[model samples]
Target chain A: MIVSGSGLVEALRAGRFVVTAELGPPRGADTDVVRKKGRALRGWVDAVNITDNQGGFVRLSSLAGSLVLLDEGVDPVMQLTARDRNRIALQSDLVSAAALGVRNVLLLSGDHPSYGDHPDAKPVFDLDSTQMVWTARNLRDHGQLLSGRSLDPPPDLHIGAVENPFAPPVGFRARRLAKKVRAGAEYVQTQLVFDVGAFAGWMAEVRDLGLHERAHIIAGIGPIVSPQALEHMRTKVPGVHVPDAVATRLLRAGTEGFTEEALRVCAESIHRIRAIEGVSGIHLMAFGREHLIPEIVDRSGLDRSRFDMNACGSRERSADAG
Target chain B: MPPPRAVPTRPALSSRTLYRLHRLLEPNGLYRFVARVVERHAWLRRPFTRTEESVKRKVFGCRMCGQCALPVTGYACPMTCPKQLRNGPCGGVLPDGGCEVYPGERCVWLIAVERAEAGGHAGDLERLHRPIDQRQWGESSWINYWQGRDDGLWTEPGGRATPVDLGLPVLVTGKGDRER
Candidate 1:
């Protein structure tokens, strides 16, 4: 079943470890890749997040990809970015997504224009991630605009925000997460996590500040594909750290066996994360390795029987079935 | 990629005017008068220059340059400036002037409108619809300015500290270093 924000929260309270995966749409107008990825992860995850622009590079609209996922019987967490839209567009998309029964959303401030293919294109940060969370909360809970104008019917959305545990001034992430929670974020999914200790410390701070009670915190884990990919993540992706031991193992595995190593690493990571008391769930960013998620889940020993498999067979299944 | 550009300097604001305004508002009587005037008329608060017709025309023809507010509004420009959409709105402006983005807060534009009206230029309201030139300044600089003002450092004696002084070495690094 498509989990509502409250449902996700309830699941966390019930000690269920929510699992989420990402689906990156193709760069062109094709929906095949997105649909395939969505279909592949159908019953393996709680929700499949359609990335707006993974790594800030240009790609198909996340909304479109999310729609495809919805069509494929996967609950989609449509990633909304303020980088290219104003409040009006943002609201319109939210309402549209809700109307289409795509309830989960990941609000993002998005990467700056400079990071994308179109550096000269103007960015529209009408609302930062925090403000977007507030907007989502207001729209969903109050059924009103900022001006208090009532919506014909308010949207019912599961709002989530991103947290980068590896961000510098690392101490500030917890506080930032606290602010997001204060702003009405129902859940927070972190950026790719390689160091469980760092993530644990960050969660400790969140607990200390009482934010844990307000939002479901999901640790993000991206499966490492190769030594080169691992090195790229460590050096290229700022704030993402791959531990020396993990990096060494992946390197020693070499190119051909990297996929196996990746699955093992990810499975272990999931296991470690699932053992954490305060951690509510795990967001798997398999990066183009969508096909391996089911294997990773199986190897990790997570209980997938709880997810609805019958719904995965057809697109017409009720979203609430799961 | 080209080397990162040097950080630009910020425009100067009159401390005398700010102090005078601060002092004037400190007295309950004067503050009430200003507040009363601002409360009655929306246009009086945020002054704009264009008429509805002109604004509409520009909106249809907007190139999205976002220049209208950058030079004048100090980086506090609205995301909805018809023509120039630099950044998103504060996410606080509610449909009714209360900010949904910032709970229990008045919209920034409403505050600006009130200030303009209180300052005696109600006609400026029409100008609020003008197209803005968003690219007039870099996003980082605009954000830096925004942050400085938010922290109350922008109005402090000497100009607010640069990203460099604030230990943002990345801001001073090569091309891609400070882009984001």
Candidate 2:
């Protein structure tokens, strides 16, 4: 039988500290980068998340990118945002992800269209993130769509949603996560985490509400490559909170010392964030710094696991699996 | 927290003017005080309630989710948006301010931002709004405000229902295809 779900799910289920990485597809039609990243990340991460036009910029569809990674023997967590697609398209894509052998799905109320490449293009937020989670739950556990229509075989999908731990009202973030879980999120990938203390507090609340029991909370970590990059994320991203110390360090790095501090920041975040009670894993959304994964892994000093042939993917299990 | 059922506010204050009043009263204790008075009032509530409902629905496309965020949103009403966006505009808003859902019309969030900018309450627009309470539908929001229907109240009510209880079930009334 095929080992279902995704590698990330397996690691979480096993109570292992999970590591997942993001793979953003290029704007053009090319699977080379996707496959390349897949191989580079194969043993390093439990799963790879393909962003759907991240930051409202146009790129290859996550579904197509996921297929490329799937072909390359990488577990791709296809992200479906409500910003561009409506319920029909979203549900259809969810079904297609299973058909295409993609097991993990991350649902988001995508950023507004105005933020993206085609500001002239219309948005289609048919459902918010909460409702999308509910819709997915109805389809998964109930084996029926929100309309009560039955499916021949419910897709073996592992549903996930995004949470901004530091988003205010800070207290409501946990409640939103609870709602997402109740609506059927098996895991949560949060906004970039720089404030570890705030995350620990959020995790405490998640544990208090027993949300951590139901959903695996994976914290998002990223390396600020440049001071400009740091500035953009801090001001433009709605819920992300970038700390001043990181900013000051990055500014002091002054481009020459950039790499060392950036690497340290990413690694230290993983180390500190891993200690949080409810954090089941770390999601490295090293947005533009995919090449730095090796440095991140080295600095974190965390246990690493090689790819399991038994895990779902096209790659056959063998002695040389890693 | 339903009121006496026969009392709704009859302030002779029109909702158009009332929206402006809310903006003014929000900082002071007056908004809550007015809400309490409206909740406790007794008599001729039906006509007043009906007028209030129709006017708000027509002018603002109010879903009346029991939490009125109009004051913070520059009175543009996030609830007026098709997605009922409480936080901010989704990335789907067109450059010309057209609705991604309705199309050919202005995005409520776009209008809200313009209002916020003009009113210099842009920070208020960025403030997070907890999910709306659907159970308060059809009830006078004025009364709900007094009862603290949503978290925007002076003090957040303790022990509210979890998101599991809050993320209501889909009605599936066949509008599923339209949202696409």
Candidate 3:
């Protein structure tokens, strides 16, 4: 009765809204921070996502971080990026993740190396995000490689992809999302959304294109902490625009109440997103403020009953009793 | 000569034809196809090239056009053309026999060495060489060709499959052969 990839899919189909949280590991090789984060959020969130050198900054490998989470009895969503590894290394890590019972995965065409701390580092885009999702799904279903050789047993993985609606050429983003769906993306977690109306418009398009039927679309929500951080996000991060009103509110609130104001905005945004017809869930990227996830979820008025211990325990009991 | 076996007419170009032509103009299709197919089917895609190489040889080697232009001149094109070594070898092969420009496999120059020796033209192997007329075909024309091929128009005479003679010496003008 363990929640497999298929189980997640089934849950989505059954109108059960899924929630996932990000776990940002420390810069060095230490696992204690990741292990602690994983342990804290265990059984609370649907899946604990291990980020891959987030923001193109250096960090422990997502593979290693996910492995630690897996050992800690938490379901891990291994984030695969085309930034660091070629197809060989990417596939190798994916197989390893599957073997270790990490069923869910997020395929990302990570930020360019120029955006990272190591600007000189080479970016290996052997396969983009859409291709990565297709690759994962293919490995899970057909047990084969691109060369058409057969795997002994195909890995079972829940393939997910990232979507950014705020990106320029908005139409291009929509088309790319559709392409990702065609490429076997079973779920899409979008870039952190500040404009609920824009997010809703995107969801409507997803419904129009029949993407909701093919994949579970999850809106990304990042809680703002300070005016400086908000300013940095708007100016620095391409494709991420925090509306002037939200920025004004944060600015007016001053440093004392910035965190509270940010949480409220995130909570309201999540509530609005959840109300959208095609939205299946929310991905809370609290940046380094991982502790704020539960608060955001609570304030968003989301029913955690599906992930509640009693419900999970009963489902297990029923399966066992049957 | 009773109509000389009706030279299998080249298909009229279309979008698909253009893409196929684009693919054909490249060194190898199987590797490209394999790369694409593997992207779509990761479980079946393997890193090792022995099986892939055999597949390429069987399916696309001589059946495809660009392979003939490969420096090896015997085996199928390795499809490992490098950006830096636009001409021939800069004599920078690594100790591992891989190209300094492209790290994984044998240098194109090194492969050409064996090929030149086999072909009894070892002397020609030492001279720096460039690729033969590598022009990107027109997209609209390619699509028309593809459509023609798909619709069986390529087999019919005067249906745009006329063999426009491409005069030879196939020079490697850095500007590419627009004249041809």
Candidate 4:
């Protein structure tokens, strides 16, 4: 039986063109920052993903940030990485998140600490991303831990895993997703995609495997916001593939009109991505610029009406606020 | 001997001998006897592990993970990956098939994938490898494998391994575990 634990899963299962966005928790112990970002993302997206120390920099815990989002009536997809925690801690966090009402989890192997602030920190990749997915599924379906111990009441979660079509061994990326699916990933959120042609080609292979029928494929898209950010993501960000054409266009746009041009590119990309066969949704990652998502979503010409907001718990919270 | 003189006996024997050797190495059948001998002598553990380390480190760049995955990973040591990814390549493989952490080097899993596909053992790549047993680090995996000590690391034919098979104690007990 499918555990429709989160509205994100429900929306996807109902064939709604879902829109999800990322929220980076602040580096300090500031709940207000999370709440503000959560509020900005509230109606614009179906769910907000609380990053788990994204980029390996120390920040507020993803669990705390997710709880803040939950308090603000924004559904949170709590990302759990295997880099920091072992299987025990991960399972503990999973059950804890469930107890606190966070139902969506996007499992990742996480960025190496060498790329983050604390390069000296010890990495505990006790489990890889696929193993983490299998752990979560084991908890949900079998009501057992990886050790096979029975949980009196298992933490019900919607399993999501990240895929990067732009990465090397491109031919094997689709098959990797197949492995994730077999491991029990119900949905897949891809890494930042700047080259639609490459993505479409990858999607063709995914179609050949009929993976789209088994899992919801959400393409990752984001506004560059600045030429510096564009370059950083293009060159510095691991697994993020930004083609030379994007860099050239952003360079031509210059600083004065870069944000507009970047958003225009993003909106246009969304239009193209929407038309791509088998893409169930778009995961907007507007790094540090949550306010622009509404404008980007509006400009993308995607029908927002398909998202039934009343079906979610956030509607009740908004009503209370009113 | 007279009948064998009619044919080129050396080529036929060489091919059959090579095939038998290959079959023997597949399960490390001969190594099991060596492992048992090493197991009986407690003093040989460190030396055996060090020897294994020197040989594998030179060839496969092995990290002495103790739960060796080389057979399934096209003989490429997955421990060499910056992240030590066992199941497959992480999403961070560079555009040119470079490692994410060390872009100059090719991603180990990518090499594993290509080699496995080439060797027609591509399905072996799909087998989900569990997390490494940290206790087994720097130990002799050959002896561990022969003794069935690392059975938990390898996926069972039925899919996931049970805790009993993994040799994990029932750590989560009644009231205290649920108290949280």
Predicted structure with the largest TM-score when compared to the true one: 4
TM-score of 2: 0.68
* lDDT scores in order: 0.59, 0.68, 0.59, 0.77
User: Predicted chain A of model 3: TM-score relative to the true chain A?
Assistant: 0.92
Position A176, candidate 4: lDDT = 82
True contacts kept of each: 0.00, 0.05, 0.00, 0.53
Which parts of model 4 are misplaced by more than 4 Å? A1-6, A306-322, B1-22, B28-31, B148-152, B155-180
Residue B64 error, candidate 1, Å: 18
Q: Write the per-residue lDDT of candidate 3 for residues A137-229, one digit (tens) a residue.
A: 656655655444556677777889888776533433564576567556888888888888877777777788788887888888898898778
| CAPRI grade, predicted model 3 | incorrect
In model 1, the runs with Cα more than 4 Å from the true position are A1-14, A311-322, B1-180
- Which docking class does model 2 fall in? incorrect
DockQ of every predicted complex: 0.03, 0.08, 0.02, 0.28
Q: Provide the lDDT at A243 for model 2.
A: 77
The lowest-lDDT stretch of 10 consecutive residues in candidate 2 chain B is: B2-11
Least lDDT summed over 10 consecutive residues: which range in candidate 4 chain A?
Answer: A313-322
Cα lDDT tens digits for candidate 2, A1-322? 2234336666677677777888889888777888788778776777889999986899989999988887867778999987788667888999989877888999988776666778777666656776677667666655676555677698888889888776544544576566567556889988888888888888998999888888888889888888777887775665567778778878888887886888888888888887677778888877767877756876787655344554345453222111
What does each candidate score in C-alpha RMSD? 14.6, 11.1, 18.1, 9.3
| TM-score of candidate 3 relative to the true fold | 0.63
Report the error of model 1 at residue A51, Å: 1.0
Residues A48-67 of candidate 1: C-alpha lDDT, one tens digit per residue: 88888765688998778878
